[model samples]
Target: MSPERFARINQMLDNRQIDLTVCLDKVHKTNNIAAVIRSADCVGIHQIHAVWPDIDMRVSGNTASGSQQWVKTIKHYRFEEAEQAFNAQNMQILTTTFSDTAVDYRDIDYTKPTAIVMGNERDGTSPEAIAAASQHILIPMIGMVQSLNVSVAAALVMYEAQRQRQLANMYGTRKLDHAYCQTMLFEQGHPVYAKACRRKQIPYPSIDEQGQIVASTEWWQRMRAPDPQALTC
Candidate 1:
């Protein structure tokens, strides 16, 4: 598939049907953060919650190719806020760390709502984040190094999620809410695709139709018809 095709599919996934998040905790390196964002998008994750004290955005902006615009990034300054948000949603917070209770990273189930947290490159997950996590994961290794960089570790974990959820055919036909999807694609300036979507009864998106970056399902509904066969016949 071409880059444009990939971008379209990514926009589709951002409709929030994927149910996974990647968050960084006060990570110092911008290149690594940028790479993490890139990796998250590469693997079909379109929402990222990042918590960093001071970020050198040049690193992320350089690699993102405006890819971040296609994704929703909620920035946080405190671990408590990040923890409270994901935890309240019952999202399984899995952190990469080599602690006594840490399990092999491959053991965790990624099919459920999940948030993978990566901590400071030098310090690993903060004590607070580790405590808040539902489980601690470690990438097992037989090599000379015991740990990988923060960004590399995140890539490995998220791909593991893709492997499990995908091998099970978890997302192929997963349909998001019809209305929410249309608004998203429409706002993406995909009027043609939006018409196709409404004609097919696909989900309408929830984007703010009048906002700066806008997409509206109402436009599609105005031009398209509900499936006739879906009616009482």
Candidate 2:
């Protein structure tokens, strides 16, 4: 990897938010999904959770403009599953919806570990998602249209979270754990070799000062060796 590339990757990982995340509940539109991913990446969110029944949760590359590649997306078959996963991480779920009880999006304390949940474009947030949410939030609208598009709504709320986090200096320093930083750096810088190591069930080779793989000669030789299982076949 080039020094420039390594430096960029390291810088991004260093500012990544480990606590903040986004969740989509039954949002099937690929374009909207991609837009949300783009916004999430801009705010240094490292992961996004998506729960959809039938549609594949893959982001549209064209719409995402390569932003999807920078963020990890976890898809769940059910909203319950997604809720439980985030809950386990101690993240408070805040679903965006129109409700009498819902509070203004800006009123919430976003500096805490939080996951902003967005719903389907047509049907709005799922009942299960609403029920599971610790708090309900909504963007104020004065026009005839009651709600904004899913992606736009997500971007609005996410940026609010980013703003609050920034005020708290969350983006001013390294927030990622040491091990995660190294792992992401290696994967981003040497994707081919990272995949090779995964396939061969071997640990990743150490990266040198210039971001070049150390002991490349020995590692490549081992990687090229035929597998014993394949030999039996």
Candidate 3:
């Protein structure tokens, strides 16, 4: 990669919010999903969880504007699976819903490990999702519409989290651990080589300061060899 491109990637990785993420529950609209991914990228969120049991989690490239390529999206067939994964990471689930117990979205502590859950375009948040949430938050609406589109709402909530995190100096330095940063940098900068290493069941080669792979020719030859276990099969 060019020095400028490498520097840009390094800067983005440095500012990535590892503790913050967004979860979509059955959000099927392509445009909305694309918009959410775009907003997530803009806010420096590295990961996004999607739970759509009945439909494939597909977003439009046009609407996503290449933002989807930067964000890591994990798809779950069920809400329970997604919830468990986030819980395992010690992240607090904050669901957006219209309920008596729901508070303003800005009231929560975004500087902490958080996963904001957004619901479907039509039904809002599901009961199970709401029940699973650690907190219920909503964007106040005084106009007749009462609610905004899922994408718009997600952008609002994500930017609010960004704003809070910024004030806390979370964006001033690298938050992601060294191992994850290295892995992500290598994967993003040399995706084809990384995928080849995965296929060969070998560890990824180290990357230089300029994002160039720093592996010996012998190592490359070894990595190209068929896996012994697969050969036995």
Best by TM-score: 2
Q: In angstroms, give how far residue 164 of model 1 lies from its true place.
A: 0.6
Cα TM-score of candidate 1: 0.71
lDDT by residue for model 3 (57-109), tens: 67999999998878888998888998998888899999999889999998999
Q: Which ten residues in a row have the lowest lDDT in candidate 2?
A: 52-61
Predicted candidate 1 versus true structure: per-residue lDDT over 76-129, tens digit per residue: 878888888897778999987888989988999998889998988788888888
Better of 2 and 3 by lDDT: 3
Error of 3 at 223 (Å): 9.1
lDDT at position 219, candidate 3 = 80
| RMSD to native, candidate 2 | 2.8
Residue 211 of model 1, lDDT score: 23
- Global lDDT of model 1: 0.73
Alpha-carbon runs more than 4 Å astray in model 1: 1-11, 14-17, 54-59, 173-183, 190-233
lDDT of each: 0.73, 0.87, 0.88
Q: Model 2 over residues 1-233: C-alpha lDDT tens digits?
A: 88899989878887789889999988888899999999999999989999978754567889999888788888888999998888888999999888878999999999899989999988999999899889999999899999999999999999999999889888857877777766777788999878878877878877766787776677789888886557888
Model 2: pairs clashing at backbone N, Cα or C within 3 Å: none
Give TM-scores for every candidate, taking all chains together and pairing residue i with residue i. Answer: 0.71, 0.88, 0.86
